[model samples]
Target: MKIVVLNGSPDSRRFELDCYLAELEGLLETRGHVVKSFELRAMNIGHCTGCWGCWVKTPGECVIRDDSQKVCRAAINSDLLLFASPVIMGFTSAVLKKISDRLIPLLHPYFEIDRGEIHHRKRYERYPAVGLLLERATDTDEEDLELIRDIYARMALDFKSELKFTGLTGNPAEEAADALDRL
Candidate 1:
């Protein structure tokens, strides 16, 4: 399996989330899965300006020529796309959200009925299964986790995929790897 990890933790120092991802990456690689991780803080990725240019002028591509293009390509080509971040103020970091918003180019401008709800059509024939790996802050609670999960589930649906896994840094990396292997 090929996996792409979008590391949205903004802190440069040694953080818990980064450590968890390092271990997870190693385990996955050892298990014969190719892993590609994009450290969002280190990359040059601009915020999505809500310009319909990606949908109109340039179909299936973001008009903004930035590192997000690499991210979009890796995400669309991966078997699993994992969103890893530290929960800040009860949600994922802003950097993660920024890149997440930029992923809109992967979908077509047209809408299609899916599960009785209107969703954008897929620009690609297949999209990666989505997963969430969160490092909880001191103030994080169950409600926050649930809300994040709900949002990502909807995001997966919008991407024409499914949310395959959700794990926390509190768990061992081996546990997370095992869960991913099951997927």
Candidate 2:
């Protein structure tokens, strides 16, 4: 499988999340999966200003010319898109949220009924399946993880995909790799 990993750790010096991703990447490579990872903190990504340019002005691309374009491109082209982050203040880091917001361009402005609810129309024929890999905060609990998963699940639905895997840095890298393999 072709996988794109969006590393949302804000601090480059933090090795806990980084180390886990490294191990996971190695395992996936050994399994013959193509993996591409992005360190968001090291990239120049603009914050989504809530402007409807990507929807109205630009059909499937963001108006802002930044690293988010690269992220969007890789995500849309990959089979799996993994969002990795360390839980911060009960949520993912600000960097992750920013890039996640920028992904609005991947959907159309028109809405469609899905499961009796409204969701944006898909801009592309195929979107990558979503995954989450989180490093829990000291105060993080089951509720927090569930909340994050629920949010990502909704996001996957919005993207016309599914959240197929979720893992933690606390777990063995092989476990996460195996989960992804099953996908």
lDDT of 2 by residue, 125-182 (tens): 9999999999999999999999999999999999999999999999999999999999
**Once superposed on the true structure, which residue ranges of model 1 sit more than 4 Å away at CA?**
none
Reference-based lDDT, each prediction: 0.95, 0.95
Cα RMSD, each candidate: 0.7, 0.7
Indicate the worst ten consecutive residues by lDDT in candidate 2. 55-64
lDDT of 1 by residue, 83-169 (tens): 999999999999999999999999999999999999999889999999999999989999999999999999999999999999999
Residue pairs with backbone overlap in model 1: none
TM-score of each: 0.98, 0.98
